[model samples]
Target: MNKTKNIAVLGGDARYLEMVKNMSKSDDIHIELVGFDQLNQGFTGAKQIDLDDLELSKLDAVILPIPGTDGLGYIETVFSDKNLQVTKEWFKKLSKHCLVFSGIANDYLINSVNEAGLSLIPLMERNDVAIYNSIPTVEGTIMIAIQNTDFTIHSSNVIVLGLGRVGMSVASKFAGLGADVHVGSRSKEDIARATEMGVTAFHMNELSAYTSQCNILINTVPALVVTNDVIKTMQSNALIIDLASKPGGTDFDYAEKRGIKALHSLGLPGIVAPKTAGEILGTVVEQIMYEQDLGEE
Candidate 1:
């Protein structure tokens, strides 16, 4: 009989629940699950471990949530009074043979893992995977806009900041529905590509001048590209949907003071399309594991 690989799951939302379900289907894996007991009530054959009882050192792999274990070394779990924390120091107690994986990597986690000589894999850092993730993000953005707005997308003027994967996907998605899309990008190739796709593209030159004409503004750029000057130019009813990370691009204070609606919609794919996101992570993690085994051989 083949020995099943032991994997440990920490805290997360519904996306994590779906991930566990997908992993359960793999014949070569046996999960020592934590933080999801009630969710797996009907699922048989998997062992449940208490928050403080299980020995992490014995596991072959430890899986963390997307945006993984923040700077404070805290684990954002849904269970255990929502107070149970998992840190890199705690991770240091794990066996040397064990591997660690998360959706993202931060400085403190990187330092601690390196000090402990542990391998840490970031699943979302892969552009190939992020590109696949962007499809759901685009769809979710459209859903949010439709739900919030009274007007139709047809003939609406939409401005998209940044032409990266999510931006490209979003621009194309809005354009597909007959909305006039204008993309803000620094790259000539991307601008040319946007033009070829039948959407108006703009370089950094005079971006604020165009801001007032937009009915909807979507920002995919992670930086603070949308300053007070830009926000001041927006129409009173124009919606600002920032898809960037936390503390996103736009000036929320200004938006609120002006009574313009500004929303920071982070982790759209996970919230709106969790099953697809989980499958993407599972597939990538499987590939990483397979490649690592091959390297060992």
Candidate 2:
């Protein structure tokens, strides 16, 4: 029995290409590639076509890039020259049963999908996906720290904000590299975990108190945790790596005014390890599709 399902893969970076390749290997998937005409190679079971050519009514699922869309709903099509907009009308065209899968979506995508009565799946929200993603994110953060700092990570005062998945990984890696790692978080359990891991732990309230001696300040929190007050307390030569999403945790304008080198790095997995990231997403998507099929049964 050929239990193939139709999927429309819309604009994205190189990761999408790897994902398509992975999914196409399975005899159960039939892929339609949109906004990817610029790519040289072709997939075995995939058809490259324009957005207009995609029959939303026939699609079992619509796969979008990790970033989903720009704030204005423009899908990120790095491989194509076309400006592909994911409007509400596009969602309206999709079959009511069709699943829309993407990474963290913007408010526009969420509202539009809701209005269109389509199911939107935010893949990054899954614990398996986020934890897997933290690997490449932390690696990229360490890469940035190594490239930007004059001194080695060894014995340096490193403060990692947020005790989330990415933060935990960042703090662990720095500590492994012989850095004096200090984890800042609000949760007492998280702080205790940091201490159990043999690293210093402090509440976020004490962030400013400890910032003055920080050589490498890595922020995984997606809030304005690194404000002007925190920046002012840091050494002028300290390096700040903000791994949160756009408009990151750090106040970039204030950091610059104070002559601090603060970098807001978004989409690290796509940048540093696209193939691995793609494989992770592809695995998760495959699982979701199988689950959906079972639900229908």
Q: Which candidate comes out best when scored by TM-score?
A: 2
In candidate 2, stretches whose alpha carbon ends up further than 4 angstroms from where it belongs are 70-72
The positional error of residue 200 in candidate 1, measured at the CA in angstroms, is 1.1
TM-score of each: 0.92, 0.95
**How well is each residue in 8-89 modelled by candidate 2, as lDDT tens digits?**
9998788888899999999989999999988999999999988888888998899988889887889888889899998888
Root-mean-square deviation per candidate: 2.2, 1.7
Residue 277, model 1: lDDT of 84
Query: Candidate 2: lDDT over CA atoms?
Result: 0.91
Error of 2 at 95 (Å): 2.1
lDDT against the true structure, per candidate, is 0.81, 0.91
